[model samples]
Target: MATTLKNRSWRLSAAALLLSFSAQAQAPEAAATPAGMSGQEMLFWVLVSLLGVLVLALVLTGILIVVQLRPQLRKVYEMPTVRPSWSGKVLGLFVGDPVLLQGRVRDEIMSGHDYDGIHEFDNDLPPWWKMGFYGTIAFAAVYLFYFHVADAGQLSQAEYETEMKQAALLVSVGSDDPNKLTDFQPLTAAADIGAGKSLFATNCAPCHGAAAEGKVGPNLTDEYWLHGGEVNHVYKTVKFGVQGKGMVAWKGKLSSKQILQVSSYILTLQGSKPANAKEPQGEKDPTATKIAMR
Candidate 1:
């Protein structure tokens, strides 16, 4: 009987070890996989890893219970009258739920502890709830190790800093907030103005005509202002755009330097009235006259 019990315990231990090894083997594969996995591929691997962890945890838990209760299990097996049913045997191997076996609950119920003819049975926690709680703990440990200890993943703050650095590369030096208007002098550099003209032809021409004359949107060459005519004001308008005014925000599409270039190019067009110019719509800005002089 002792030999039989040892054999059973050894088998259970070996099975648990095998499962542990299987779960560990997946770590190398995950590490070896390319980081540029598609969304669906990443999700599939994540689910598979979680499933393997859950199965390994359950197997370990069952093996622990079996090893701890080896003597009791042997005695139950030797006693024909108290032998567990087929379902009970399966449950004992995996869940170890005493309620599934006949006479198993006798030791579980509180003796003479009845209130109003109600008796309480001390049962183990539900497997799902216990496993879920344990899984969260495991996840937290892995997250801490991955982000803080091993430095394998970026923390939120680190990621934010990295993104800010990347964005800084796209913007020119002395860039100001697009939301706040600043007295930005128009860029007179030939290269900036040329780039601005090219961009305006591509993006703005469909709304504001090719020569800054009015099309679906207002004429950009006129001194009359719908929003404002100052170079700074034009910069703001181009960056944020006017709501319900057909102008789409270009902050994300154009860098700050590019927007400045476009605004400067528009300023250079003052007084050069294009053919078929739209009728001036807004109050004229005296500032436009001063900017045009620059």
Candidate 2:
């Protein structure tokens, strides 16, 4: 019985020792988890290693090429003692091979024609500069087609007209921005003038005449003025009309933008001829935006 009990006790001790060893192995495996890598990290390292290997192979190939050509290069050409940078080697790609004359390559690119015994080689334009010139030509052709023929893009004049329309539209829609309120910007576009022409014929033509040659009011086509001939002054005169001279204020009846438009149109009438035109009224101002009454 004692012998059997002792064997059972020894077996129990061996089992406990095995459990301890198993626990230690399990703990180390759990601790290693924080130091583990994800699939992306593994892929990144693999790609980097492959790139490094490829770069190494290319370097080795370049070294081999240099070694193979060294003997020929030493025999035929005079190479610089100092080594060139990798960037210089990259620039050499565009520059082509070095000359056998041991001088700058530009010195060899002389014109073929000679003057006063001065010999000249062929004049070849740089590929980069020629490419830029060709690119500008292509751009000009595309611009002509797109803006003039196809009408796919806007020209400077077209863009100006479009912006003016948008601005006037905003004003018509009752926008109350201070910039728009005090806006003295005048548009000389034909469409803008046409809109103003309609307003003028309906309102001011009784006094100013259809051709702005003046009836009861002063001649607008002449280089003479009642108030002033500057753009902003013209706009102001139209806005708050000269009440004492039988010119009624149209501010309440017309929009500020409409008044400005008519003012710009009136400026365009300078130097125009009309049948039975009224005589000029006011003194000429030097600062007037005039195109001379010719």
What Cα-based lDDT does every candidate model obtain? 0.76, 0.67
Model 2, residue pairs in steric clash: 110-121, 111-120, 111-121, 112-120, 112-121
Best model number under lDDT: 1
Candidate 1 clashes between residue pairs 3 or more apart in a chain or in different chains: none
Question: Residue 60: error of model 1 in Å?
Answer: 51
Q: In candidate 1, what residue range of length 10 has the lowest lDDT sum?
A: 98-107
Model 2 segments more than 4 A misplaced: 1-183, 290-294
Q: Encode model 1's per-residue lDDT on 1-294: one tens digit a residue.
A: 656756665676667666766766766654655678877897698678767766775666556667767667666655665445654454455334444332333336688889998878876565556768999999999999999899999989999999988987776554455544677788888888888889899999999999989899998887799888988888889988888877899978999899989888888888888999999889899877433322
lDDT of 2 by residue, 271-291 (tens): 777877898899886656742
Candidate 1 ranges with C-alpha deviation above 4 Å: 1-179, 290-294
- Residue 219 accuracy (lDDT) in model 1: 86
Q: Each prediction's TM-score against the native?
A: 0.39, 0.36
Model 2 scores worst on lDDT over the 10 consecutive residues at: 96-105
